[model samples]
Target: MSRPRRFLPSVSLLTAFEAVLRTGSTAAAARELDLTQGAVSRLVQNLESQLGQPLFLRERRRLIPTEAARAYGRDISRALDLVARASMELAANPGGGVLSLAILPAFGTRWLAPRLAGFLSAHPGITINLATRLKRFNFAAEGFDAAIHFGVDDWRGAGHLRLFDETLVACAAPAFLRANPIRQPADVHALPLLQIETRPTAWPEWFRAHGLVAPLPRGMLFDQFAPMTQAAIHGLGVALLPEFLAMPDLDEGRLQRLPGAPVSGTGSYWLVWPEARADYPPVVALRDWLAAETADLRAREGAGDGADDGDRTRTP
Candidate 1:
């Protein structure tokens, strides 16, 4: 009828085991833990005795971890990281917390950077850190509180709020446009059309939307728009660029829109965070502020004329 006692290893024993496994020697582990080498050895021996297994193989002066110890070290690595992060957070934000965000490079620079000042101004107590991540990542493992994600609402294990759809317009450098002189959507097929690896069907979809059948030949491929826009400006070829990313170049007379109306791409930007942190204050504040900003931008877009195509454009 009595409950069985739980047998948990002491923190020192676990730390010694992890340190020895990581450094491959008790001496190194002792140096790392700031303890005597004899103490570290005793701790590891105690841990092995408690677990009833040999964590290390003794060969002369060398200590080699068994496969089981190797796996255990890997498991404890993440736990140790979380502990360190928690300690650092406690030290850094005694009065508040930090919000770490992962963002796409082009979108972050062109869109989010301009708006981040307002967010920081309002949330003066919270420290906001931004890192550029071109691909989706594990939020918990990477220590991100939220991310600016593009594409559909399919980031596995995260809750997403749609920010804005992407509108892609065909663009070329002014000199390239002058020399190429594309008159209609069909004229684009004859030129070197730059392609974005993420959106392979952009050109074909645009052509289809305009009632034209494009062969959609392969062209020079670039991963991100910052470089792709630069390539287009340097007269590499015409590129299908998001209207917002292309605006500065258009205004500076570095790039020009190819003949035809801008077509909608099949993706949108989303503010994504882990579902478990849905009600967390920082995440909620960011989500609500983003929603308001998106609504205001949409209202402006709706009221704008074609003169500022960047503001007026939206993807389907």
Candidate 2:
């Protein structure tokens, strides 16, 4: 399309022409628009120049409309009014836009998603669109409003408020712990180690936390926690699991914490967003809500729904 130039009529011209055609005189249109008669006449001329069609006939000190002018004016006038109404609605509420967020599938399903209705109840007008990702993402290019992401605090160009500090426990089936008899940290070396792809060195890390620096065990590593924890439940092997993520399994008697120390993982979760839009209304609201949720969980000390945590299964 050609760029708008000096010769082309602007929307001002169209407005003046339409007004004059409705009222039958440039002076009347000028009065209605709170402008000078000469200014309105100029606008009519500009409109003709752009449309390449005379919108009005020069009558005796008055403007007479062409058939096309009346039809176009009615449609454009209604459209402009509708635009004004919609713009007013949006300006009244900045928090009502679709909130696009990226999250890990398991974490979203396990934690944040379950409690999302709370946010919705307070901000019902806000729409949420969730996209799942296994790793951190580029917030700007991805068009995300915020992300509930897991990793060490390494995100660049994003404002990261740490959601939680992870406490990882080595948990296995009760039957497995009974059969394996992990009397000390090093005793984990003897068991068949079930592991996840992201943290195969968990056993080493747990051992290191207790002052033992043996090589991490070799084992079957899966990409996700659900399957890896399931392997632990079926007595496949011991898996180093996050207290937040694995606590439920331990409570259900599907897994038990071994008799050893806990390893701190790189991080747990963070409410992340681009630095530019970090203070946006929706982002700030979500950040506050998630921080509150994490704080509440920490106060419970891994005990609420996950009551049967690692502490009880320590086989003295």
Local accuracy of candidate 1 as per-residue lDDT tens digits, 1-316? 5543234676778888899888878999999999999999999898888878998899997898999989887877777787787688768976657778899999999998998899879887777788999898887778788999889777777777777778999999989888888888888888888888888899899889889997757678999888889999999998999998999889989999988999888887888888767777888888888888888665654734323222111222
* Model 2 agreement with the true structure over 1-316: per-residue lDDT tens digits: 7966755446687678768877879889999999999999988887787778887877677577888888877866765564564466467655575567898776887787778999988777776779888876666446677887676545776666666666789888988888888777778777787777776566677777888776546667889887888888888888888887887887888888887767788665777777777667777778777767677655655535342221111111
lDDT of each: 0.83, 0.74
Clash number for model 1? 0
> Top model by lDDT, which number?
1
TM-score, candidate number 2: 0.62
**Candidate 1: deviation at residue 297, Å?**
3.9
Residue pairs clashing, model 2:
none
